[model samples]
Target: MELNILAVGDVVSPAGVKYLRTMLRKLKQQYCVDFCVVNGENAAMVGLTPSHADEILDAGADVITLGNHTWNCRDIVPMMEDCPYLLRPANFPPQQPGRGWGIFETKAGPVAVVNLIGRCDMAFGPDNPFLLMEKLLPQLDTKLILVDFHAEATSEKLAMGYHLDGRVSAVWGTHTHVPTADCQILPQGTGYITDLGMTGPARSILGVLPEQSVAGFRGELTSRFKAAPGPCKLEGAVFTIDTATGRCVHAEGVRIHEN
Candidate 1:
């Protein structure tokens, strides 16, 4: 009784959407993926219209997770209420734009997928994930729980993973966009990864052209970041978890590059 959960990295623009379809279209059968999740905080950087979010949903993602940039596109706020599948950081103030969790019906049963933000250098939200998760875990009727820990600090992500290891089925980190070397099943049975690599132009720096990001770093001039175009790369992981044991049966990193 194992279920495949494909978690994709940050999807930034139209090109990114195409990459997702191209790379993940074969995954349903190839990976036996029963559920697919993606982070879409960067969707509108190339200027996300509401159409951008819809495109991701229509492309193949079952649940679209987001981060601090969730509110970047103001128009997408209304989409949140209608599309509960789209989730922003749960720790965001209660007045935030999107939901924190979604109930997914899988072959095993219903699974709870939570989108959480770390309170380090990132957004200073009112709710605490450590405290909030303890309360939220009990309320969920399903044992198969997955969390997307989007944070800037490595300490935050790693600490959270240790904290929730036995409680959830898997804890996948995002936001940095660089895949970490650490990936394993925790003592408590939860599958864990420090960060799932991003899906975008791999040659670029975390989805943006290196030159552009470097310019900003140098503080020479402010430049609007754009998704690096051309051949793409998809980065993330697929975790198969047992419903009865609430443990990961298998966990593997997925990296596909399109030339």
Candidate 2:
């Protein structure tokens, strides 16, 4: 049997949320998606809250993964514990409020989903994701495993893809907010991509207003950053997994501009 899974990129703002709410279901149907995961750390422009997570879930996200900004909203700390489908990076301290991985029962079968952050050049320090996976992978009972490797560096993301190539069903990168052209199945049957890009404003710098990002880069602004205004775009990937063998049969990048 083949299982179709859609992994969406970071949702950046209210506009992005609106776009997902309006279009995700249609996309799922169009692709015959059996499962869905969404990176939603930036759903609130800066961080995510419980309400924002709810919005994404209601919009059709079966699992919501978070990244570096995972703790920007205190309310999410508790929500993460209560919401089984919401995940923070597993490499975080064990005492962290929420879990880093979960197993969800889907029509296709049970799928294990993991969220991990990269340590190199990241804003916050976390345990080694590679080592953490070594311990976590063996614990999962399911073979249809999907990982959201949220990192800033392409090297780290690529290393992770190769490391888990034959072990997991797919490893999709996030956090960079720029989609890469390289989307392919690894030699060992894993689907991989450097980044899934951002699901937010089409005319912005990584979902933030270009002017704001430029000002910050130029050291001319100290104000808080804001999401840009305009049409939204959704970027991500669709993975087709061979459930019988727990291998990814196909993977493709997907980008849609809001009409």
Which candidate number maximizes TM-score? 2
Which pairs of residues have clashing backbones in candidate 2? none
Best candidate per lDDT, number?
A: 2
TM-score of 1: 0.95
lDDT (CA) for every model shown?
0.83, 0.94
Report RMSD for candidate 1: 1.5
In model 1, which regions exceed 4 Å deviation?
A: 46-48
Per-candidate TM-scores read 0.95, 0.98
How well is each residue in 80-125 modelled by candidate 2, as lDDT tens digits? 8889999999999999899999999988779999999999898778
lDDT of 2 at 229: 93
Tell me the deviation in Å of residue 99 in model 1.
1.5
How many residue-pair clashes does candidate 2 contain?
0
